[model samples]
Target: MRRFKLGLAAVLSLLLVLLAGCQAIGGVDVSKAVLGTLDVKSSMSKQTLSLQLVPADGKLKEEDRKAIEILNSLSVTIDQAILQDSKHMSMEGAVQFSGKKLPFHVAIDPKTMKLFVEGMTQPASVPLDMQELDMAFAGTKMTDETIMESYKDIFGFLLKHAPNPSSISVTPVTDTVNGESLSLQKLHIDIRGDELADLAKGFLTSLSKDQEGMKELIGRLYDTYYPIFAAYAGTSEDGKNALSKADKEKQINEAVKELTSMLNELLPDYDKNVKELLADSPELKDILSKNTVLSLDLMLDSKLKIRKQIMDLTVQLPATEDLPIKQVKVRSETEMWKINEPVTVHDVDSSKGVWDVTPGEGSPGAMLRHVDRQSELYRLLKDDLKITHKSFTLYSDEDPSILYDAGYEPVIVKGTLMVPVKYVADQLDADLKWDKATKQMTLTDDLTGSKIVLKMGSKEASIDGVAQTLSQPVQSFEGYAYVPMKFITKALGAEGYWDAKELVLTIERN
Candidate 1:
């Protein structure tokens, strides 16, 4: 369901694209008006979320009951958010857990786009350069207006092939927001999570067939990054670049062609991939398509601004032997006020102390910098969680402060993931032993006692005593073994996604 969950998120873009200043079903021209209001100068809003679980057959397993109990005790409120534009936004919120309201203040500095946080377990302020964070993988910075305008066509193309794109309904309505009665246009969507089976396969097939659209999109996107690419060449301290502007343009074109060619090579197997995915998890389609409903409602004011928003999802698990949980209801609502009015985001007083994290071994260490050793927040992240930054590094998840950065990062060789053998073993809490005389290494999972044995310079390995073929052989450098990360993670029942741009692998524990 993780793949489905991620792909389903694309519906958000479809929501934005549908409002690209177009006519509605009732001949209403509200889409244009609403789209105009997205690029707001200043605004403030409040949001809240609540979750509830429904048991199946009035019975719940111990773990399911515990999850529901925790959900019942937890609450969160987005007190308010202020922004002077897309770049400058600040939020204050509180999470009520264990009968404690843990207040936190977060702000995005307009000047540097750095994120500042405070009031959790740490008494001092924490500042992080968000742009440098690996999670910010989007190409270049663009405002809401720029994005919606530029990608409208691409969004339309994807939605055209998705199942029941017209399921979204628009209605004229008057809604009260923040104690103000106002005329509004409501855009609402109700979709079953499983209905997306066709969408997944259809999107891949449609895109592969539409060479013109793909080429146009690729060209348009590369062109949009012209400035970003040019800036790299222009900002060299030596005042001379290895690649000139013309060379950069040529490189961009070549990259686009290469990427397009790669896709072309793979597009032919879309059907095969889809069939395999379905065959691997045949129950996935039934569980989601029949038992999950995702709904979103947007209330827009006359100026095309969304004054109120609501999203609700209900997921009902089938009577599967493994998954004991039954149903989950998640709802979120936000009401807006002070639209376009002059406002200033809340700022933190850095006079006390500020932990500014850099990109290195010490990065996540700052999260626990000012944390009280005995505090709940400290215990939660440091002890309760197997903390690891995706496409980056992992820290010790034990009590006395978690693992440190591996010093070296993971690399992708010929499409296979290779990481420091010790890092993966430690993060997965597996025991690792190297046999010098035999030129072999063995990893035994702590929980299941499963074993994965790899021999040096061999394209073969044994998982749980079962032999398997590897994409590449185990390699060692400077006394450290570089093992196939995919093999280790999968063998240990883990999952990971690698960020090629940063040369980091995110091997997540299942």
Candidate 2:
């Protein structure tokens, strides 16, 4: 039974992943506009959940007494009682006795159509009618399928009672109740309003027509809810307790005060990081604007998948002097995952792609492959693979002398190449400095103060300890310094390999 409950929990968690961002139950919208203010006020009433038992002997067993005690203790801890505008709601009631006898407490809310069980574990099934549960469980052995079907029934019951029942699922649990098997089940319910549905449909429809408007709408929606969701999820227990009562007005005020103080203290540094990210990714501004709904969908997907790749991004507008903007504030809050891989540069014709560079280990290096030049590949080689910046270079074995020594033969037909200077410096923990006045490039190792200088249009180079002669002169073009791609890279302890298709330069250290 315990294993079955655990399996059920795992299945529910997996379902949440698959169902995220899906418009389940068709066109339902549960946005803030539809739900009004989600300022739910919850209160509890004192009630002892009792259970009646009938034994095989037609008489009460002594073990039933111990079972009741266990049930009472469990009920006190797990039972959830809430008062929403005088509509009372409670969850989970159970009683247990000694000598391995146990009885479960059952309560029903006719208004909400929610069933509360004490001692049996799991929430009252949703959307499922009583008849459905009886039919599903009848003649079935205790198995994960039985528990899952039962929970689905309960979820259906809850959906029927919800104001806006759009998307719903159950959370995972494991049963560990003493003397009886029980599992705690959480029902995740999403309610949508008519307005929200219209907004979603409008947004999706606009994607094919008015892309700019879609972008703006998505940005606005993101700004509107990001902070609200962040606060709700991040709020401390004390903060929640303070907001639970109207009488604790002062407490609520204090909590808000403390929260603002914390934000003020933290926002300056946070804003700087956001600024840096935005500088590199300007499109994020539109994605995080106030009118956007796609942002919410992205966030919900991230949370369900447990990925942290995009979460560090925060968008802000440029500050002005007269306004004296000390810090950029994030008014709305939503979570995103962080992505660590190098950013890809597309559209070589665009201004951002003019450099023909790709991000390397430490800085950007020149891109060696042209992804869209189809004629060049067909004229040179017969392969049909599409090219990207990372595409491997190809070479013919007939021209082995150009890349490798005459004694060595090439076996692989494909290879890759990189800029030699950046590759070398990155591995050695060194920095590259350029002097425009003399067209001289310097490589400096900060740890050892060792330097190498190469002057443009000159075949002579100077290492820190000795002068060396280069087979090819250093070259400079368009504010970038270029050296003999093969010789300089080889001198820096990097390796160069050429295959039938391409040449590759790789850093050997760090």
Candidate 3:
């Protein structure tokens, strides 16, 4: 049951993220145009979100209690904020829980990219690399014009397939704030019952009818959006138009291969669950296909910049013999202010002093001085980490060379490489204790005493006594434990990626 919920949540979350990504990119130009700047100040914004599970039968299960608690804790208020541009943003906000307000202030500048703790004698900052945040679109070639055009096509495709909205209305209003007269526009939108499902079906049906057309549209979007991301990755950091055609193709191909490999590895589990679900009952599919509605109320300034948005959505999930779930309702609202003015800080120059931008760790900078390109760690992939499908054996420059000396060669599993757990444990100086009776191995960081326990053939692990479900379980070969190289390394505080252009797995521990 937990797995079912998790799977559904994962699928829904992925869909939401995808939709949000498209909307965010599509709306950026509109925001910039309407606001005259990409930055807006919100001095007072309030939000509330609530969710209720109306079961077909009476009462709720214990497991459902957690969901209700989470839904109840959704009240928040942003008292003030300032951001002249993306390069500088700050906010003071609080989360309201049980009549108590937990306050927080966040200031982010691209230079420091760290959130500074305020009202303290000495300001402290967390290590966050803001510069690298834009890597999502690093390889794109999108211009304002093309981005808008793409958004139009996307929205057209969606609206054409889905049922038309039940109602949409716009009105104008005027108000004065802080001695400034403001003109605002209000928008109301509502869509009801099974409309979204029909729209989704329409989208899928369209893709089936013109797969090539869908591919072309996606390809164009990819080409436009990925260049900046690739540039941030140092793959094409030059002033040239972007990565060369060959390099771009290489990167794209590498990304596809990596994705395909990962999917293949997870496909079996997904396939089994899907088959079981379909065979057991058709009710789940019916629940998804049933009618649903969403209502939105929005306020915008004269420039068509959004100042507030409220949403109410309800899904009627018909109950079945096996599952008694009936319906779900969600409501949320957000309000903001000072939308017409540019955010500015007069106390200090944001581009100087603590706000001055700094390169991320391992990046060449004034403080770090230089990035050792020739270092063993940097050369882990025999070139830049951007290279595709290029294989280079791992070696540690540390005094003991625990990883390299372990003579652990990568093992191919599910079309991906697995590395010895001993290498990773030793690299972190985590002590490995074996319990033969339980067939479990416990890894404890010698310095921190943080423990992670793994049992052979089990996809579940325990990290610091909390259960963690793994995408892949621990396996054994020749009496040594092996795990997914990327997962194990990441657990040990390392980062890994498949370099664009190929299926090469590059793990870097810094």
TM-score of candidate 1 versus the correct structure, residues matched by position:
0.56
Tell me which of candidates 1 and 2 scores higher on lDDT. Answer: 1
Reference-based lDDT, each prediction:
0.62, 0.35, 0.52
Span of ten consecutive residues with least summed lDDT in model 1: 395-404
Q: 378-432 in candidate 3: lDDT tens per residue?
A: 2322232322121234433432212333436555566555677776666555578
Every model's TM-score: 0.56, 0.24, 0.45
lDDT string for model 2 (92-202, tens) is 333323222232232233222333222212223233244554444333343334444444443332222222224444344443222233333323443222223223232
Q: Which stretches of candidate 2 lie over 4 Å from their true place?
A: 1-430, 445-450, 476-481, 498-510
lDDT value for candidate 2?
0.35
TM match of model 3 to true structure:
0.45
lDDT (C-alpha) at residue 451 in model 2: 77
Who is ahead in lDDT, 2 or 3?
3
